[model samples]
Target: MRRSPDLHLPQATRASAGNLPAFLAACAVAVPVLLAVSAGNIADPIVRYDDYPALLAQPEGFWQKTLTEGRWLNYLWHLRGVVTPAWLNFVLFQILWGVTAAAIAAAAIPPGNRKWFAAVLALTLLPAPPVFLMAPWSSTLIPGFAVLALFAGLALVLSQRALRLLLPVFTLLAFTAYTTFPLILLAVCLISTRQRSLPDLAGLLVLFGASFAGAVLAVYALNWQVHGVFGIPLDPARSPDPAQDLAELWSHLPLLQETLSVLLGKLSFQSTPVLLFHLGLLIAATAVLLRRQPLEALYLWTALWAGMALMTLQVLKLGVTIPVRAFHFTWILYAVLIVRAAQELSRSPGLPGRLARNAVLLVALSYLVQTAVQFTRFRDWQHETRAMAAAISAQPGPVYATGSILDHPAARKAGLHRASSLELLTGLQLSQCGAVPEACAHLPPRLSSPAPEPQPQARLERFEGANVLVFPPRQ
Candidate 1:
């Protein structure tokens, strides 16, 4: 590969030697905010198509599904649920991901300010614009697996050949779960790394390219093991047919501005244009300031542009709008900007310094407000789901949805983006069948018909885009 003269890399520094302590402290600082971010899920409601507690509870379910599509990491992620409550399991993983993100950021930044950088990064993740924290279930939590994989890649950069050999194993376990952010975050780390042990800008590109190729191969292999097929689904959670999802992305390629808006957190329930703007401005400023260090600024610019291109595809079932959890790159980008701004401000004293500081503060404050609103929506969603469940359970033999939509503002906001079924809220053991086929629309006489057979408890209902909250999840 040709090394571009324009690519200037950061000089090597030794301040990051205390990464172990910084990593621990960053986790401590991030936990409380993470808890607050998803507090509503602690009490009630599962969002979207989350499998979590229900599917995980089964003996041969999420907890024991090792080597599954090479996504065994996600199942391992939830093993805590076996001992802790569902809410705690959900919150813990969110915190873990935040901490992992922070550690990666801290390591990639200047040594002197790494701790503060990590802490700020941690604070930004949950309360950030793309408030994926408000969601519950296995699908949202899968992002953590990607973060872990990114962290592993960073470790590989420093590890000797022996440990670097384990990179493939780590990729096999993590890449099958999520891919949108791993490539982006790895690039960020490589650019930000002080020369200490890292190579030049071209080496950074080589590193990311190698990491990506390894992850893809791992997923390619794992898909065969778990899905009993030979295919590469960049993210298996989207759909069994990832090719269709890719088609959705290709179709939306022309709507660049519109698609970018969605990627930056402009969903029905979470509208955060301002937070994203501040993040952009702050990072852009940081990049300009680092132009002297050729590589960092270029990667900053590259990360933003690359992010716009590598969009998270909204599976065919959900249309073309990607889910908020898929915005992991955005979360990392904001965190990196905050830290980079702080590092620059400390070195200078002027109006630009104040502006950078204010930009970061505004970004944080904006995210805080968005996070609160998201949680309030979550609380309202749970309350309405419970009330509706009660109303449905009190009915006669079988309750057909009067209308497919739930009658609540929060639920309408949720509409087709949330959980498999509100039946979990009903808390009744009554036999429930999903989407009664046209042929089975009318049932036999209750007196002559045998007792309603108990249905499988798993959330395996096919999603036909009609009221996602009421329907059982896809198998």
Candidate 2:
């Protein structure tokens, strides 16, 4: 039997409804102001990386084929035009992803528990964590949007009315339209829970399944359009053996940790108070879950285990040794756990238990303060991108980007030649390289056929004639 939301609640319980004014006020101020500042300084240097070059070069045709075909239909990106430095436009949108995290924390808790709601909101908005710093640059924007979709799903589940349930579905669809992974994971988690009804269960499964299928199709279509093959033709030059690749990633792990630690507030871990503060919160959150919120605890534990297991193979293959990208997803599961912890805290009637919970609040509050301080660094770091773009823009001759920027409109408009790397630019003609490669020397022999002679000095030589913009992210 389905339980109505209104009938299930305690009389004193409050939803986040009353706190709207404050939350909105914070979001309204923070999201725009930060974007505006970044726009004033940031430049859209979408010419350096894998997806960036392709997307910028053909945003519309790409997305159009994507929807009609099945993958990152570059059509929309092309239509959107090159995301330029318009202040608080797309550049700022990247920063705003954090708001979704806050909103999820907000929706995960019952509205009645105003304090926890505020805490979650504050925590997310507080600062950029080590996870955001020194890792894949996309963290500034991507996860926040994913989180917003998540909170919307949560809202539907908790809503007392039918209309409210529909809202989550709409939100989920929107998010699914944007990015499929988080919402897919969220749907999996939601439907697996015992509390949901058949309709709730069925809807999520269908949506996730269909979207996943669509994405796969889109990718195939993209391969077809770019390479004239239904599938991406294996390029021996680009593929690397997964096992050996794994070794390279392992060698880089220590550096990754050091970068993360710095984001956590340590030049060195030995005496950093910031390290102690976060470690303490982690302990507290763990203890509270183990002691009281066992179900939620189990969910979080499963999410971590599953996420780690799933990402491990990709990490090993892709050579993405760092855990920052994985952490972004894990954090949401943790946020859900925190909500459960807060729920348990509310249910405890004794003074000692209440006081212990209060201690948890104090610690959370402290973490929030630390987070805000660290987040300010993101605002500062935006300058580095602006500087890099300006340097390339000022350079003579056609600009060619090797990584994510090739897809961006700005680089394509600048008539940049696309290549997998500086070495490739020196060695191959644009027609020879094509949109996607026919032979990837970087890939493993099993995945592709090999044998492009090492262009020993080609990488250095390529930049001699053309301008190359390299951010050379910290390893």
Per-residue accuracy of model 1 over 1-475 as CA lDDT, tens digit each? 9985535632221232355566666767766766775666665545453464433444245532334334545655555454445565566556666666556555655565667666765565546545454355534354454557355335524533323344445444445445454554544454445542325545555655576677766655665676665544333443333344556645554444455655544532344665456557765666655754555655655665555545533343233445565566666665665557566665667887677666666666566666666666566566666766655545534433312233324555554353235554555433322343342244333211223223211111112322112322222
The local distance difference test score of each candidate is 0.51, 0.42
Measured with C-alpha atoms, the lDDT of residue 45 in candidate 1 is: 42
Model 2: per-residue Cα lDDT over 1-475, one tens digit each: 9876667664223343443543454355445544443342244322223334333344532433333323342233345545443332345344445355444444445444555454544454333343333222331233334444455434424433432334344433343233324442452355225344557445644554565455455556655776566743323443433446547767645544543544334311235664575456556667887886555555556555554544554445443333343345544554455445655666757774565456555544554454334344434224434554455446554443332333333333333344343322232232222234443333333223212332211111124455533222112
- lDDT for model 1, please: 0.51
The number of residue pairs in model 2 that clash at the backbone is 71
Counting clashing residue pairs in each candidate, in order, gives 5, 71
